[model samples]
Target: MSQTLTSDQKDALQEVTNIAMGQAASTLATILSTFVTISVPRINIPEVSEIGSAISKMVGNGKEVTAVRQSFAGHLRGEAIIIYGQEGCRDLADLMGYDEDIDQSAERELLLDIANVLIGACLNGIADILQTGLTFAPPSIMAERVIINSLIDPTQLTWNNALLVEVNFTLEARNFSCHLVTLMPEDSIERLKQAIDTFMENF
Candidate 1:
């Protein structure tokens, strides 16, 4: 895997997401009738093996997670996404008065609805500023015991290696913490730098 985004580039990334995440927080607050606090976005680019474990550690058990993937092409090119585990979703659901007795079977629909709201709000903010359009595959879930690689389609990857940028976030209602991860090609580093620089100029 190639580490293309340098420190400055990474900072630019976090800054861009800071604005988007705040927008997501606003979206959640209106729906749940509560405030949502977003932490400072941190940048993490992970290797193949590190991806699972690092992600596992971030969004531990007993939390609801929403994972989103959107490809970004421009001066800064890569996939931009958000991943929120069960914790925030459950808390938000509770706040919104959703059924508390959700089981494994019901999770399929539950997760899709959550992903639609959270990821949609986040990327909408991003696309508005970047003047970019993003495409998405339907969001799905792997059960509690499943490995991420097992569920992901292998054909989508161009190589054995991948570069992923992860930003940590905490939702305020009940202190739900999870990750927002973005993946991209090694060649996209330059584009990332340019995109960040552009965002910062306006910021």
Candidate 2:
């Protein structure tokens, strides 16, 4: 697997992710009825084995997290893992019209709902820009209040390399935040390069 991306390729992927992130933020904002803010989407090309450590660093320390894992396939194929800090999950639950007292079922429902919206919108945005069709599997709760290292099992890697798109989201009103990490397979790199080439030629 290629360990790095060319400058132009990185630029093209970042542009694609930024556009996707913007659309995701809009969708989340509309869902919660509040303004949502997203940071610049960042890309990381890491071996499948190192993804756990990468996620740990992005999630920081002393925070328990839960993740919803969803897979998408089309021109690109990979998983979208949305990790929410436990405290942030409670805030999000409240924002979504759930009661302040959240039980296990409520939390699960909240996580799945938010994950479906954010992951679905972002992936669709990428598919639209790349002009590729994509279908998603129903999302499932991967981990609950677990450490990042345990959230992903290396044994489940379907590919050798991963394109990690790190997007940080914040709801200003509730002071809630979460990290949405989209892991695209090795083939996505080649597909993205071709799409970018076509996109540039058409411009």
Candidate 3:
């Protein structure tokens, strides 16, 4: 089933997402000791078959990337995937005081660390705004040095369509950037709409 959101509902979700992403950006700034900027959140409901190409375009087609995946469950349920370009990874490692020749394990650790921070902070912010709770699975390296187009196999997804929330965080000075894509299946989207409705009632 398709998830349809009214205009006001869409606006409400966007507002909450903006606040949540701002919190994520603040956490990132604190960690990197640099200013971090976030793009306005974009929300879409795309067919599973198109998810791979949609994300590929968001991260840049053909770019080799590393990704971390974390699943959250509770009043809201979804998977948060963080995509990092090669330069972004190197910049992050440098910011974390890694040597130029850091080992593979160390790099993976760095990726997981930052991904956990951003995803946790962002999702928690959303939960806070909605006065709900969410628990996250440990972040795992979903793909290492894989091209964006190949990162996700749509056939492996159980759902035919999903509500996708996309946002980007950039440390401009360091030229480091990552995209956080949150996917919620149909049932979760229905739950989210009800939550949004409840949230708007108070305003």
Error of 1 at 57 (Å): 4.2
- The segments of candidate 2 whose C-alpha lies over 4 angstroms from its true place after superposition are 97-100
Q: For residues 105-151, what per-residue lDDT tens digits would candidate 2 score against the true structure?
A: 97797689889987887778767768888999999998888877677
Using TM-score as the measure, what is the rank order of every candidate, best first? 3, 2, 1
lDDT of 1 by residue, 79-150 (tens): 544455545557655655568785645555655555555555555555555566665555555344333433
Number of residue pairs clashing in candidate 3, backbone atoms closer than 3 angstroms, sequence gap of 3 or more or interchain: 0
Error of 3 at 92 (Å): 1.8
lDDT of 3 by residue, 1-203 (tens): 55668888888878887887787778777867888888888876655667878888778999999999999998778788888998888887877788999888988987888889878877786787668889999999998899998888878865445555667666755667688777776777777788789888989
Cα error of candidate 2 at position 110, Å:
2.1
As a whole number from 0 to 100, the lDDT of residue 119 in candidate 1 is 56
Candidate 1 differs from the real structure by a C-alpha RMSD in angstroms, to one decimal, of: 4.5
For model 1, give the 10-residue run with minimal summed lDDT: 158-167
lDDT of 2 at 153: 63
Better of 2 and 3 by lDDT: 3
lDDT of 2: 0.77
Which stretches in model 1 have alpha-carbon errors above 4 Å? 60-89, 103-110, 121-130, 142-173, 198-203
Better of 2 and 3 by TM-score: 3
RMSD for all candidates, in order, please.
4.5, 2.3, 2.2
